[model samples]
Target: MPLSSEPKLISGNANRPLASAIARRMSMHRALNVELVDARVERFNDGEIFVEMFENVRGQDMFIIQPTSNPANDNLMELLIMTDALRRSSAQRITAVIPYFGYARQDRRAKARTPISAKLVANMLTEAGVERVLTMDLHAAQIQGFFDIPVDNLYASPVFALDIKHHFRGNIDDVMVVSPDVGGVARARELAKRINAPLAIVDKRREKAGEVAEMTVIGDVSGKSCIIVDDICDTAGTLCKAAETLINAGAAEVHAYITHGVLSGPAVERIENSVMKSLVITDSIEAPEPVANARNIRIVPTAPLFAQAIMSIWQGNSVSSLFDHETLSTIYDGFYSAS
Candidate 1:
């Protein structure tokens, strides 16, 4: 595709590798090959954060590739400051390409008095001069409504569907797509339809944060491989318990395809000890060594999808078309695999 203008790509401390991969994809496609803007984010002696963009972005299309992952507060602050800097520098358009949007879990107030941090973050980004937001698999789809700007919420279903098809060698009838809880049924059901598999739901009740009160498999998982689908897998308390519940209910094996592997606290240890066959995640957030090195965990790259989405936005094309099976298959064949 011929480009009218070259968009500058910027990276934060959250995930430099993903940013580099996205730039490479742009070059491979000959779409909008632009180098990452020279910028430095440093920390002071007292642990304050500072960001300085060296390259000129005046009247340019700028895309900032940063995931608000671990050390979410600091990384988010870096993005905000960078957006402010770009606005002051006269950038024509600023798109915040956040792969894994943090604070998305706090989208609603479950208690009597609590802050909707997701909306607050959206307001901060808008006020910081971000014109658009590109993110994937929000914890709650309603979070997209919180943003006033054009928000592109991408899906991991295409990627996972490709991987699952390869892993099962197009024979997915014996595989069951499972939702760990009621909230994730939509995502799980979509994957189930993609692979032509049966649907199952785990009726799990969480009495409190980080604690699952009860888990009951709602469908027949007997003698079938179960794949739990969810957006985030933080702490793994619910995931591990769900796996055990599935196995106890006669599932031949238990696995998962989660979008973001926020795997905090004892997540790695819990996965290692759980009965789960595997836990697949996308490179939306950087996985720590324990997860990368784990035998039961696999991470798929998401740069290609984001690269195409960014290119489409720059070209004024439709980003939703990329989700089509035929289109996704062509894209995945070039980059993704069972590895």
Candidate 2:
């Protein structure tokens, strides 16, 4: 592996641990010379972001790992600035590896005069000179159309499926994958298919954002263990309410497997008192202290998955194969050994 061929992996303040983990995995194989680029992103007293790359990245492929989670504006601006810096440094290519794309929920114009923040973000990244985009489980799959560059929208179902299997010990006779709302049925169905379990949906109406009306169980959850699947969990209002509804409908147990744990506001406290047996989430967003300390919550690392995808992308191989169990099971099998 020559230094010239190694891809430069950069990290923003968003999720440094996750970026470090990806770099570690990329270097583990030894054959791939991918390494984290030496860089510093700092904020001035007036809150302006400044990015400095210590090493030369001239004509090298660069992947910037940053998740626009909490403090979404600052982190997003950091990513844009970092990309612009790398572009000016003459990097051969720049890929924005955004694990959790903030403002994704506001992807559409729900009202007459509202803006499509997701599209605006795509435009910003493009204007910042990013040549490629990589993210996982966007709130709306259609958000990919918002980008002019190639966008790889990865799924957490493979990771979630592996963890679910380990916890259930291959016993899925009474397991049921549930969609918290009508919009999430596709995601829930994919997980259900992977686990070979029945699918259920929670019928609920929302009068406004972050609030859910009383939910009704649409399928037979009686005596069946249920796992609610969704792309994001912000306030956990809908999740908590759905869990209660499932319990009232005679569900044996209720769990949640959301891709992004935005866990804002009173989300942690809500989960603490909710009827959910467990709450599983991927490390797409750097969870806060309360989410990390939550008893019923478990965090799964997604660095390996992203690393493999990046490797495939750089090698010009099929990135989709990384999600195939037969091809990558060994790679992801022990990822959650701590759990």
lDDT per residue for candidate 2 within 110-203, as digits (tens), equals 8899999999999999999999999999889899999989999888998888888778864578899999989899999998988789999999
Q: Write down the worst ten-residue block by lDDT for model 1.
A: 330-339
| Per-candidate total of colliding backbone pairs | 0, 0
Q: Which ten residues in a row have the lowest lDDT in candidate 2?
A: 330-339
> Over the full model, what C-alpha lDDT does candidate 1 score relative to the true structure?
0.90
Scored against the true structure, residue 151 in model 2 reaches a CA lDDT of 93
lDDT of 1 by residue, 1-339 (tens): 423368789998899999999999888876455678999988899988888889888988899999999899999998999898899999989999999999998989998889999999999999999999999998898998998889999999988888888887745778999999888899999989988899999998878876788999999999999999999999998899999999999999999999999999999999999999999999999877999999999999898889889988988889998676557777767554533
Please give the RMSD of candidate 1 to the true structure.
Answer: 1.9
Runs of candidate 1 with Cα error greater than 4 angstroms are 1-4, 207-209, 336-339
lDDT of 2: 0.88
Count steric clashes of candidate 1.
0
